[model samples]
Each structure stands twice: as C-alpha cells, then as structure tokens.
Target: MLLCLDIGNTNIKAGIFEGEELIAHWRFSTQRHRLADEYAALFLNLFALNGIRLRDIRGCAVACVVPPLRVVFEEMIQRYLGVNPLIVGPGIKTGIRLAVENPREVGADRVANAVATFRRYGGPAIAIAFGTATVFDVISREGEYLGGAIAPGIIVAAEALVTAAAQLYQVELIRPPRAIGRNTIQAMQSGLILGFASMVEGMIQRLQAELEEPARVIATGGLADTIAQEVRSIQVVDPHLTLHGLRFLYELNRRR
Candidate 1:
C-alpha cells in the first residue's frame, strides 16, 4: 500500500492506496505545533480504524505547503512507517513541463494537481483548487504547466469581511435562496458564495480567452463541490485530485 499526504495551509489530507485503488482517506485540521510523535499516534489510530497497519505501507509520498509540518511528517514517516517519504519538490520527477518563471516557486500541491489534471483529463485544462487560497492552474494543449491566478479563498474572504465590518458577523457558507438577499445572513451568503461563483465563471472566461482554446475546468480542494455546484464553468470536481497526483508522482519517481 502507498500512503499519500497533502499538507495544505488549512488541512492535512491523507490517502491509503492499495495499488492504484484508494482504500481509505481522511482529513484533519493542520496544527503546526503538533510534534512528530503526536502525529504518528494520530495516524496510527486512523490506520487502525481503517483496518490498515503501518507495516502494510511500502512507500509514502507527500506534497506539503507548510514547511514546519512537512518536516514533522517526514520525521514521523521515517520513524513510524520506516519509509522515507518522496517529498514533492525540487528533484522529484514530475512528468509535466513547468512553463513558469521559477519552477521552485510553484507549490507542490499545485504541481500535484497539474500532474493529475493533465494525466487524467489531458490538456488544454484548468484546475481550480479551493484551499487556504483558491488557486487556478492551467495546462496547455501540449501538457505544459502554464501558471494561472490566485485569489482569496471563500472562508478567508468571509473572515476579512467580518473583521473589517463592525456589524457583520461570520455566517454559514451556503448559497442564498436568491441573489437579492432578504436579510443580513442571506446577504452575506449571497455575496460570498454567489459572488465567488461569478468570480470563478468570469476567470474561466478570461483564461479561455487568453489561451485561445477551450479547456476543461476541474475543481478540487475542500470547498470545491460547494462552489462547483453554483458555477457552470466547473466541469468536474475531484476532491482527491491532489492525493491521486501524489500517487502518480510517486510512481514516476519510485526507486527502481
């Protein structure tokens, strides 16, 4: 079995794959202060609950954005699982050609998403990941990793609105019954959810215009399904895109 981890700013997503089949997966809040032993114990409990043992995992791959947590997981995997995880960064064999200014500046999670997108859906394609920050990664028809845009995540935007405004408080992120909001809560929801849906559609239009080619827009990350349901441009929502990408990358660079 292969254990794949995608450590993002907001959450840590993990998957256990038996061959190419993802047998189990879980998500947990990201705590930078957590120690290696603590993480190991938590992972052990999760694995036990899923009827998996540490010894069953032959290899591990990670795509981590949090530097501190990345080191913690690396240490935990080495000590507990007895496997040195394949970190997705410089020197990893990602089969896509990065057409960005500095390839190293690209986040590992974004790279994973690109790899999975091009491999699974082919290019021209766009992947919108709604995580700590909503990121749009574009792939050319030739399978090149063309850089895209980034915007404030839905939660981040909502928090900022609440923080800045004196009267407005945080509200649940659900679509309002109508675009013309009836109350304060509905107004906030409409502005956050429906506004973001429009933003996504507009961005897709702009990207397609710039690319001069039609591309399939795929959404991922925690709130993908939520936003995707409102956006017409988003064709597919694969929450496990990053996980599958890590597995694909691991396969590409697995020790022979």
Candidate 2:
C-alpha cells in the first residue's frame, strides 16, 4: 500500500492507498511540537484501528508546508515503514511549469494541489484552496503555474476578528439566510462565510477578466466543500486533491 501524508499548516492528513484506490484516510491537528515517537504512536493507533500494519506500507510520499515537522515525519516513516519518504519541493517533477519569480517559494502543498488540478482539468485554470490561508493558484492556457493571490482563510479571518474585537465571539462559519444578518453572531458568520466566498468570486472574476481565455475554477482543501456549498462560482471540489497529487508525484519521481 502507498502511504501519503499532506502536512498543512492547520491539519495533518494521511492516506493509505491500495493501488489507485484510497483504502483509508485520517486527519489530525498539525502538532509541530510533537516528537518523532509521538507521531509514530499516532500513526500506529490509526493503523491498528483500521486493521492495517506498519509492515504493509510499501512506500511513502509527503507534501508538507510546516518545515519543522518535515524531519520528524521523515524519521517516523523511516523507523516505522522502513522507507524514506519522497518529499515534494524544488526539483520534484510536478509536470507543471512554475512561472513564479522564485518557484522554490511556493508551498509544496500548493504546488501539489495546482499540479493535480491542472492535470485533472487542464489549464487555463484557477484553484482556490481553503487552508490556513486561502490561496489562489492560477495556471495559464499554456499550462504554466502563474502565481495568484492569497488571503486570510475563513477561520483565520474569523479568529482575527474575534481576537481584535472584545465584543465579538467565535462563530460557526456558516452561511446565513440573507447577506444582511439579523443578529451579531449571524452577522459575523455571514460576514466570514459569505464574505469569504464573495472575495473568492471577485478574485476569480478579476482573474478571468485579466486573461484572454476562460479559466475553469476548482476548489480544494479541508474546508472546500463547506465553502463551495455556499459559493456558486466554485466549479469543482476535491478534498483529496493533495494526496492524489502526492501519489502522482511519487510515481513520477520513482521512475526517475
């Protein structure tokens, strides 16, 4: 089985793949302070619950944005699975041309998401990833990773609002009946959820206007489905896009 891990800023996602089919997957908080043994124990418990064995893992791949956790996970994988993980970064064959000023500056998770999205739905395309930061990765008609914009994610923005305003409390990020809310909590929720959706739609529209060709907008990340549910502009939402990209990247690099 192929073991893939996507360590984002807020969450760590792990997937066990039996060939091309994902057999089991789990998500946990991204504990940057966790030790290698602690991470191993967490993985062991997850595997045990699903009737999977550490010895059954054939290979591993990782897409991590948290630099501190990279070595920790790598050490854990090596000790537990007896295989060094293929880390996604510069020099990785993602099958996409990065047009950014410094391609290395791009997050591995974002790169993986863009590569997978473009491959699945060829460019010109725009990928709105709802993560720690809501990222907009754009691909040109020629299939180049033309960097896009970034904004505070829904959760981050909400947290900021709550922290900055003493009167405001953290509310569930959900869409209300109307754009104008009736109460303070509803208003905050509406502003964060619908407002974020509007921000995405506006950015995408502006992006489309700037491009001569039309771009297909796709959404991914943990909060994708929830946000996309309310936003009409988002065309597709693939929660496991990063893992699929990691799998694709693994295959690409394995042959090389």
Candidate 3:
C-alpha cells in the first residue's frame, strides 16, 4: 500500500492506496504546530480504524503546499512509516512539460492536478482546484503545463467581506432560491455562490479562447461539486485528483 498526502493550506487529505486502488482516505484540519509524533499517532489511529497496519504501507508520496508541514510530514514518514516520502517539488519526474515562465513558482498541488488531469482525461484540459486560493491549471493537447489563472476562493472572498464590512456576517455558501436575493443572507449566498459560478463560466470561456480551442474543464476540491452543479462548463469533478496525481508521480520516480 502507498500512503499519499495532499497537504493544503486549509486541510490535509490522506489516502491509502493498495496498488492503483484507493482503499481508504481521510481528511483533517491543517495544524502547522502539530509535532511529528502527534501526526504519527493520528495516522496510527486512522490506520487501525481502517484495518491497515503501519507495516503494510510500502511507500509514501506527498504533495504539500504548506511549507512548514513538509518537514513535519517528512520526519513523521521517516520515523514512523520507515520510508522516505517522494515529495512533489524540484527534481520530481512529473512527465509534463511546464510551459510557464517560472516552473518553480507553480504550486506542487497544481502540478499534481495537471499531471492527473492530463493522464486521466488527456488535453487540452483545464483543471480548477477550489482550495485556499482557487487555481486553474491548463494542460495542452501535447501534455504541456500551460499556466492558467488564480482567484480568491469562494470561502476566502466571503470571509473577507465579513471581516471588512461591519454589519455583514458570514453566511452559508449555498445558492439562493433566486439570483435576486430576498434577504441579507440570501444576498450573500447569491453573491458568493451564484456569482462564483458566473465567474467560473466566464473564466473557462476566456481560457478556452486563449487556448484557441475548447478544452475539457475539470473541477476538484471541497467546493468543486457545489459550484460545478451551478456551472455548465465544468465537465468532471474528482475530489481525489491530487491523491491520484501523487500516486502517478510516485510511480514515475519510484526506485527501480
């Protein structure tokens, strides 16, 4: 079994794969202050609940956006799993040509998404990850990682509005009964959810124009399904895209 970790700014998503099949997965809040032993304990408890033993995990792959947690997880994997994790960063064999200005500036999560998207769906394809910051990564028909766009995530935008405005408080991020909201909560939801849907559609159109052809739109992340239902442009939603990408990357660079 391979342990795949997708550590983002908001959450840490872990998956245990038996070969290519993901047997079990879990999500936890990202805590930067947590020690290696604490993480090890948490993983051990999860493994026990899932009927997976620590010794069964043969390899580990990590796609971490949180810099502080990288060393924490690396240490935990080395100390507890007894295997050095394949961290997604420089020197990793991603099997995609990065056409961006500075490839190093690209987030590891984005790379993972691109790798998985292109491999699974092929290109031209656009992968939108609605995480801490909503990111759109474009892959060409020839498997080139053409950089896309980034915008403030729906939750982030809603939180910012609540923080800046004195009267407005946070509301549930759901689509209102109608676009013309009846009340304050409805208005906020309309703006946050429906408005985001419109933004996604428009961005997809713009990106497709730049690509000079129509591309398959893939959405992932916690809010992906919610927003994807509202937008017609998003064709696929696979929440575990990053985990699969980690597995793919691990296979690409595994010691022979």
Candidate 4:
C-alpha cells in the first residue's frame, strides 16, 4: 500500500492506497511540536483501526507545507515503514512547469493541487484551495503552472474580525438565510460565509479575465464545500485533489 500525505498548516490529510485505489484516509490536526515517535504512534493507531498492517505499507509520499514537520515525518516513515518518502520538493518529477518568477516560493500542496487539477481536469484550469489562506493556483492551456492570487481565508478573516471587535465573538461558519441578517450570529455568518463567497466569485472573474481564455475552475480544501455552494463559478470540488496528486507524483518518481 502507498501512503500519501498532504500536510497543511491546520490539518494533515492522509490516504492509504492499495495500488491506484485509495483504501482509507484520515485527517489529524497539525501538531508541529510532535516528535517522530508521536506521529508514528498516531498512524499506528489509525492503521490498527482500519485493519491495515504496519508492514504492509510499501511506499510513502508527502506534500508538506510545515517546514518543521518535514524531518518528523521523514524519520517516522523511515523507521516504521522502512521506506524513504518521496517528499514533494524541487527535485520531484512532477510534469507541470512552474512559470512563476520564484517557483521555489510556491507551496508543495499547491503544486500537488496543480498536478492533480491538470491531470484530472486538464488545463487551462484554476484550483482554489480554501485552507488557512485561500490560495488560487492557475494552470495554462499547455499545463504550465502559472501563478494565481491569495486572500485571507474564511476562518482567518472571521477570527480576525472577532478578535478586533470587542463585542463580536466566534460563530458557526454557516450560511445565513438572508444576505442582510437580523441577528448577531446570523449577521456574522452572512458576512463571513457569504462575504467570502462573493469574494470567490469576483476573484474568479478577475482571474478568467486575466487568463484571456476560458478556464475550468475547481475548488478544494476544508472550507471548499462551505463556500463553493455560494459561488456559481465553481462547479467541481475534489477534497482529495492534493492526495491524488501526491500519489500521481509518487508513481512518476517511484524507484525502478
């Protein structure tokens, strides 16, 4: 089985694939301070619960944004699975060409998303990841990784709003009945959820206009379902896009 991990700022998305088929997947909150042993224990428990044997894992692939956790997973995988994980980075054999000014500045998760987006949905395409930061990754018709925009994510914006305002407090991130809410919670919900939805719509138009060609837009990440429903421009939302991409990349660079 192949273990593919998409480690983000807020959460770590993991998938266990038997060949090309994903058999099991799980999400764990990102803990940067966790040791290699701790991570291994967590995975062991998950594997046991899923009826997977520790020795059954043949290979592992990772797309990690947290720099500190890189070595942590690397150590865990090497010791537990006895496999050198194919970490998504500069030397990886992803087919997409990065056309940005500073390609190194791009995150591994974004790269995986682009690879999966173009491979699964072809290009010109746009992938919007609604995570800690709302990221927009654009791909050209020829499958080049053209850069996109970034904005404050829904949760980040909402938290900031609440923190900055003394009277405001945290509310459930759900859609309000009306755009103009009658109550405090509803109003906050409308402003955070609907407001981000509107922002997504506007950004799609702006990106499409700049691209000069009609691009297929897709959404992913935790908050994708929450906000995607409100945006007409987004028609596809594959939460496992990054995981799929990591698997694809691992297949490409697997030792012969």
Candidate 5:
C-alpha cells in the first residue's frame, strides 16, 4: 500500500492506498508544533484501527503546504514506516506546464490539484480550492498551468468579519433561507453564504470567458461542499484531488 499525506494549513489528511484504490483515509487538525513521535503514534493508532500494520506500507508520498510539518512528516515516515516518502516541491515531476511568473511560489497542493484535474478532465479546466484561502487554478486547453486568483476563504472571511465587528458573532456556514433575510443572524449568514457562492459563480463565469475554451469548473477543499451545494457552475467536487496528484507525481518520479 502507498501512503499519501496532504498537509494543509488547517488540516492534515492521510490516505492509505492499496495500489490505485484508496482503502483508508483520516483527517487531523494541523498542529505545527507537534513532535514527530506524536505524529507517528497518531498514524500508528489509525492504522491499527483499520487493521493495517506498519510493514504493509511499501511506499509513501506527501503534498504539504505547511513548511514546518514537512520535516516532521519526513522523519515520521523514515523512523516509523521505514520508507522515504516523496515530498512534492521544486524538483518534483508533475508533467504539467506551469505558466506562473514564479512557478516556485506556487504551493504543492495547488500543483497537485492541477495535475489531477488535467488527468481526470483533460485540458482547459479550472479548479477552485476552498481551503485556508480560496484558490482558482486554471489549466489551458493545451494543458498549461495558467495561474489564477486567490481570495480569503469563506470561513476565514467570515471569521474576520466576526472578529472586526463588535456586535456580530460567528454563525453556521449554511445558506440563509432566502437571499433577503428576515433577522440579523439570518441576514448575516445569507450575505456571507449566498454572497460568497455568487462571487464564486461570477468569477468562474469571467474565467471561462477569458480562457481559450469553456473551462470545466471543479471544487476541492474542506469548504468546497458548502459552496458547491449552492453554486451551479462547479461540476465536480473531488476532495482528494491533491492526494491523487501527489500519487501521480510519485509514480512519475519513482520509475525514473
């Protein structure tokens, strides 16, 4: 089995794949200061619960946005699993043409999403990742990685609003009963939820217009489900897009 880990700003996602089939997956809060042993122990317990042994893990790969956790994961895999996991970074073989001004600045998760999107949907696609920051990554018709926009994510933006305003409090991320709200809390929720969905649809519309062809829109991330539920433009929501991307890159480079 191949172990795939995706460390985002908010969460650490781990998946155990038996060949190409993902057999077990788990999510944990991202604790940057956690010790390597702690991380290893956590994985060990998870594996035990799933009837997996450490010896069964033959290979591993990771796609991480949190830089501090990189070494942590490297050590965990090396010490516990006895295999060096492929860490996605500058030298990784993604096979996707990146058109960013400074390609190195792009996050590994973003790159992985691009690779997976192209692999699944072919070319001229846009993947909107609803994570710490909502990101829109564009893939050209020729499979080039054209960079897209980044905005504060729905939850982050909502939290900021709640923090800045003295009276407003945090509300559920669900959409308001109607676009026009009857009460204060409902109105605030409606504005943030439906308003954000509208913003996503509007951006996708503009992106499709500017691209070489009508791009297929896909959403991936923790908040993807909430926004995608209301938005009609998002065609697919593959939460494991980045993990699959890492697996693809691992196969590409491991053979070489």
Candidate 6:
C-alpha cells in the first residue's frame, strides 16, 4: 500500500492506496503552524477509522505547494509512517517533459496533474485546479508540460471585494438564476460564479486557439465542481487527479 498526499495552500488531501485501488482518502484544512505530531495524530485517527494501520503503509509520495508544510510532512512521515516519502520537486522522474521557461518554478501539484492527465487521458489537455489560486496547466499533444495561467480564485475575489466594498457581503457561490441579477446577492453570485464560468470558457478558447487543436479539459480542487458546473468546456471534474498523479510518480521514481 502507498500513501499519497497532495498538499495545497488550502487543504492537505491524503489517500491510501492498496495497489492501484484508492482504499481511503481524506482532506484536512492546511494549518502551517501545526506540529508533525499533531498532523500525525489527525491522520492516524483517520486511518483507524478507515481500518488502515500505520504499518499498512509501505511507501509514500507527496506533492506539496506549501514549502513549510513539505518539511513538516516529511518529518511527520519519517516519525510516524516510517517511510522516506518521495517529495515531488525538481529531479523527480515524472515521465513528462516540461516545456515551460522555468520548469523549477512549476508547482509540484501541476507536475503531478500533468503526469496523471497524460497517463490517464493523454494530451493535449488542460487541467484547472480551483484552489487558493485557480491554476490552468497545459499539456501538449507530445506529453509535455506547456505552462498556463493563474487567476485569483472566486473565494479570493469575493473576499477581496467584501474587504474593499462597504456594503457587499459574501454570498453563496452559486450560479445566479439569470445573468441579469435582480438583487445584490444574485448580482454577486452572477459575478463570482457565472463570471468565472465565462473566464473559463474564454480561457479554454484562447488556449485551444494557441494549440490549434481541441484539447480535453479536466478540473480539480475544492472549488472545481462549483466552477465546472457552470463551465461547458470542462470535460471531467476529477477531485483526486493530483492524488493519482502522486501515486503514479511514486511507482515511477521509487527506489528499486
């Protein structure tokens, strides 16, 4: 069995895989100040609930965007799980070429997404992760990471708006009944949800235009389902894309 983790700015998604089958998975809020023992306790409790023991974990892989949490999880895994987890970063064997300007600057989560997308669906492909920052990662037809765009996530935009504006408060990020909002809440919803959907559509068109060919679009992250619900361009809403990517990379790069 392998333990795979995709640590993002907003959440830490962990999965326990028995062979290729993901047996158990869970998500926890990202707490930077949390101790290794504290994280271990929370996960071990989750493992117990799922009937997975610590020793059941043979190997581990991680794709962490938060640098501090990388070291923290490394320590936690070493102390509790007793495996030297493969932390995805530069020099990892992803089996996918990165054609970007600075591959080092690419997020591990993005690399994992690229590897998983190519392995599972092949390219050309676009993976949108709607987390702290809504990220778009493009994979070429040749299975290369071709880089994409980043935009403020809807929650971030909403929070910023609420902070800046005196009267507007946060509203549920659901699609408005109509584009022409009748009320303040409806207006905010229209701008946040429907507006993001339009951005997604336009971005897909622009990216597809640059590719000069149609590419499959997949989405992940906490808010992926919300945005994908309104966007017609998204073909798949795979919440665990990054986890599967970690699992695949573990098999590829683990010591023989």
In model 5, where is the ten-residue run with the lowest total lDDT? 242-251
Greater-TM-score candidate between 4 and 5: 4
Q: Residue by residue across 45-69, what tens digits does model 6's lDDT show?
A: 8988988888888999999999999
Q: After TM-score superposition, what is the CA distance of residue 252 in candidate 1 from its true location, in Å?
A: 0.2
Candidate lDDT values, in order: 0.95, 0.88, 0.94, 0.93, 0.89, 0.91
**Per-residue CA lDDT of candidate 5, range 108-192, in tens?**
8899899999988888999999988999999998889999999988888989999999998989888788988898789888988
TM-score of each: 0.98, 0.97, 0.99, 0.98, 0.97, 0.98
Error of 4 at 88 (Å): 0.7
Q: Where in model 2 is the C-alpha error above 4 Å?
A: none
What does candidate 4 score on TM? 0.98
**Model 6: residues with Cα > 4 Å off, grouped in runs:** none
Q: Mark the regions of model 4 whose C-alpha exceeds 4 Å error after superposition.
A: none
* Residue-level lDDT for 108 in candidate 3: 91
**Model 1 regions more than 4 Å off:** none
lDDT of 3 by residue, 1-256 (tens): 9999999999999999998899999999999999999999999999999999988999999999899999999999999999999999987889999998999998999999999999999999999999889899999999999999999998889999999999999898877999998999999999999999999999999999999988999999999999999999999999999999999999999953
Q: Cα lDDT of model 5 overall? A: 0.89
Superposed Cα deviation of residue 90, candidate 2 (Å): 1.2
Clashing residue pairs, backbone N/CA/C < 3 A, model 4: none
Assess candidate 6 and give its TM-score to the true structure: 0.98
